[model samples]
Target chain A: GAGVSQSPSNKVTEKGKDVELRCDPISGHTALYWYRQRLGQGLEFLIYFQGNSAPDKSGLPSDRFSAERTGESVSTLTIQRTQQEDSAVYLCASSFFRGVQETQYFGPGTRLLVL
Target chain B: DQQVKQNSPSLSVQEGRISILNCDYTNSMFDYFLWYKKYPAEGPTFLISISSIKDKNEDGRFTVFLNKSAKHLSLHIVPSQPGDSAVYFCAASARVFGNEKLTFGTGTRLTIIP
Candidate 1:
């Protein structure tokens, strides 16, 4: 089975431009997540989508960051007016469902560099 | 405040030796803990996990020990291999409304010298 996957392995953009990153979760996975990792830092939670329920956007750092997941499949994270601070690796993950012990499968992240 | 903390930024061990990595948490509500391994230019891969109900869980040469009272956990890899060299991340989560959002600690870069 194919694991979770993301597009545009590397993206370089102007600080004021907007960028959209895409993620394709594994088949049958109902739980998808977006995270950010800065240099020498840990993974920061961004947003999560669980099935058809309302997505959890509490982890989103600012109003400029937003995500949308259609049903239980693909998800897109859009950053408006990107800043240099937003440069980092954007990782995507998916699991069967949000359970007490569910394991998440990750993708090869998309590295975004804001100039 | 960081809910999960990996005090050590890096660790180096000789191949065939035991490697132990530690993690601490400030939130007692975290009922599940997990460890993940990541290589350069790649996303993290889930290694092992332990539930609050158990003190220890082992798989192959990997063992995760949790001390609920002290709010600490550790991952031990026996007979470490060069292939095991990577950044290890400790993550925790509190199940709220079936949520699986995780709080991760700054990763520990492990270098296995052969």
Candidate 2:
């Protein structure tokens, strides 16, 4: 079976520009999550989706950051008016519908550099 | 305040030796703990996990030990191999049920010298 995949392995954009990152979860995975990894830091939770229920946006840093997942397949994270501080690796993960304790499989991640 | 802490930024061990990585958390409500291994340019992969009910869990050469009283946990890799060299992260969640939040500690880079 194929693993989770992300597009645009590397993205370099000017500050204040908007960028969108995409994620494709593994087949049959019903839980998806997004996280940010800043340099020299641990993974920070961003957002999560479970099936058709309302997505968990509690971890989103600001209103400028938003994500939408269509059904249980793919998700897109959009950052509006990006700042230099937003530069980091964006990771997406998926797991079986067994709840938070279930093991999650991660994608390679998309590295965003705000110049 | 950082909920989870990995005081050691790095560790070095000789190949075929035992390697120990430690982590501590301030939140007493956490019930599940996990360890992840990551390489440069890649996302973290789940290594092993332990629930609050169990003090220790082992998988092949990897073992995770949890001390509830001390609010601490450690991952032990016996006979460390060069391929195990990477950043190891410790994470904890308050609940094992639905919609639980995971708090992660700063990773510890492990270097295995052959």
Q: Number of the top candidate by lDDT?
A: 1
Residue ranges of candidate 1 with Cα displaced over 4 Å: none
lDDT at A64 for candidate 2?
A: 95
Per-residue alpha-carbon lDDT of model 1 for A1-115, expressed as tens digits? Answer: 4888999899999999999999999989988889999877899999888874545888899999988888679899999999999999999999887355698889999999999
Measured against the true structure, the TM-scores of the candidates, in listed sequence, are: 0.97, 0.96
Instruction: Please give, as one word, the docking class of candidate 1.
Output: high
lDDT tens digits, residues B5-109, model 1? Answer: 999999999999999999999998899899999999999999999999999999999999999999999999998999999999999988863578889999999
Model 2 / residue A60 / CA error / Å? 0.7
How large a fraction of the reference contact set does each model reproduce?
0.86, 0.74
What are the runs in model 2 whose C-alpha is more than 4 Å off?
none
* Candidate 2 lDDT by residue in tens digits, B1-114: 899999999999999999999999999989999999999998899999999999999999999999999999999999899999999999988653346557899999999999
What C-alpha lDDT do the candidate models reach, one value each?
A: 0.92, 0.91
Q: DockQ of candidate 2?
A: 0.77
Worst lDDT window (10 residues) for model 2 chain B? B94-103
